[model samples]
Target: MEPRKLLSSLFYFSLLSLLSANQQVVDSAHHHHHHRHRHLFDFRPSKLFVFGDSYADTGNIGRSLAGSWKQPYGITFPGKPAGRFSDGRVLTDYLVEIGTALLLIAAKFVGIKSPIPYKFRRVGGKHLRNGMNFAYGGTGVFQSTSPLPNMTTQIGFFQQLIKEGVYNSLELQQSSVALLVLSGNDYSAYISKNGSSQGFPSFITQVVNQLVLNLKMIQELGLKKIAVTTLQPLGCLPFSTAASSFQQCNGTQNALVNLHNLLLQQAVAKLNNETTNDHSTFVILDLNTAFMTVFTNKGDHLGSTRFENPLKPCCVGISNGDVCGSVDESGTKKYTVCENPEAAFFWDTVHPTQAGWRSVYSALQANLQQL
Candidate 1:
């Protein structure tokens, strides 16, 4: 019953097919090629404005309370924690990284680095042209568990930067994309705050309503394109999957997620209808479906990704009392990392590994072209 012991038993999975994983990556590139030529003639954005919680946080959180600043968080990419909530790159990084390589691949994308965090805006002055990532760990559309800035406050920071003449409106309207990664921190806060399950439906409506307002604010701010991710399947996250020994998702929780995603789609459709002239005013990344695709196709590696333990986190606490980033008084780590992070899906309890995000992004490529 011990936590680490439970992991030791659960992780008796067969050795993952590294060749299959590599082939999956190659197939992902080929899918990108399917649309590569299409992007060549499109007006590719040079700047990316990111907002939301830890799912897209790129070092905006400080070292005091965030595990992102601790060891093993970013070991897969930068070789150390650079504040991304995962092992390495997140959805935000994949977007910028892939788009930056467009120039060479016939996609006509201009090279751009991950947007500088607002926390480093002063020292990272020149990089402001690449846009800003104002997202913080554990934040939500409304007030959430962590005391960091919520969506409103994050947007306020972006507005303040504009007021200081840190950005030009013309460039924003001409060649910038706003990525809003809202991955259900609101529901986490709701449950943690003892919100009644009976009122959950109404709360989901309220969350999506506020989210629509945020999208409008960003759109009215003159960004050329705005992309918002639908809520991923929260019920399939490791925390929810633990009850199934990482074999199946919690269907009860997933039903709620389906409701949330439906509402979000309706809201986005209305917004696009009202504001779209020649181009779409808003873009949906279909994250909910993408996540489902990965989960449902876990064992069928014929044409999809190969995640042997799709619901199991790669890193976990060695004991029930510890967490992925827990350390003892001696400053010794209390967690265990899998031998191959690239072969895992979920990184900790909630976020994905770099490979996990890569797979999810690969699955979402068709949806991404809308952006």
Candidate 2:
């Protein structure tokens, strides 16, 4: 492929992968476990039920389909690929690391490690203690991008788990938390379907409407504490910023994101108002604010980690017709990696480096207290 076509293809990959049913989210910026979570350092939940796209998927996507299952993706942390979208741990790993130490979900310091993915549920023995990860790559609140399973379908899987007696009603009510992450794949689908930008806001409303239904369903299904992430600034993703040489963001796209977030906030607020009497049920992980903080603050959390180019990716195709983990038939790597992935905010076109996620997590501690 030509240079321009390669860039165009990468851009397409960015949009499509942005909300794949599951992948990476918040990192410690440099995998800094020492960073204080003043609010959640002692707050521990019995189980965490994670849902939605690539942003929170620890390892749900199939090995054959996901680039995350390939090499150089998890090179920074475990020294090998283990189904993470970034170079290291993502939000889910941080949330479940052992005793405030997220060395990849050993259950953060007295907390449970990242739960076993649903695919491994049958074979995952002790690993199933914390909860289950049902996220799939390339999925959304409504069906889009991939046919694997939408959020509703993912919820149905959870519902089945509950029916199988994997989790009792007491755990769901007293100590379980559900993490829901929805990237912009639905909007990507809308654009791909030739939906006019003029109709985008209405579409945002429709999307949020469906999201609320999912949220309510989770509540009805029994989890008392649910954490849903606000959309990150879509314009700041590398694919969007690449057009500006990674020096600026597309305000028009961000404006649409703001609209979706506003409607979502309102809906969550209403749900809380009607549902909460003693303790709140819904918590918003403001990925938008946390992500913006990292973009502006650079390497605030890491001892020495810094993102010189916050909107640029650390791993990329070497040239035309390749992607982050692309490999040639001759068993040669097709992508180039940066000297240090921790210093780059993005790992690939659509996801954050572990360091980037850590920075975002540092900013999100206050909100996690609610969970």
TM-scores, in order shown? 0.84, 0.84
**For residue 83, what is the lDDT in candidate 2?**
80
Q: lDDT of all predictions, in order shown?
A: 0.69, 0.69
Off by over 4 Å in 1: 1-42, 100-108, 299-305, 366-371
Off by over 4 Å in 2: 1-44, 98-110, 301-304, 366-371
Error of 2 at 131 (Å): 0.6
Tens digit of lDDT per residue, candidate 2, span 1-371? Answer: 23223223323432332321111122221122223223233344767788876777778877766788888889987878888778998878876763222211222335666878888888755677788988776667776545467889999999987898877777777667787877776777677667897888788888889988999889888775576777788888887787898899778777777777777777766676576332335656667766776787775444356778798899898886677988898989999999988789899888889988777767555333322
Report lDDT (Cα) of residue 277, candidate 1: 47
> Lowest-scoring 10 consecutive residues by lDDT in candidate 1?
11-20
Q: Estimate the lDDT of model 1.
A: 0.69
Tens digits of lDDT, candidate 1, 1-371: 33232222211110010001112222333343434334434656778889987778898877865678888889998999898888999878877886622232224666678889889999755778788899876667886445678888898888887787888788787777888877776776666557898998999899889989999889778774676776777767787788788888777777777677677767766665576343434556666666677777762223445788789999998988676888999999999999999888889877889988777766666434433
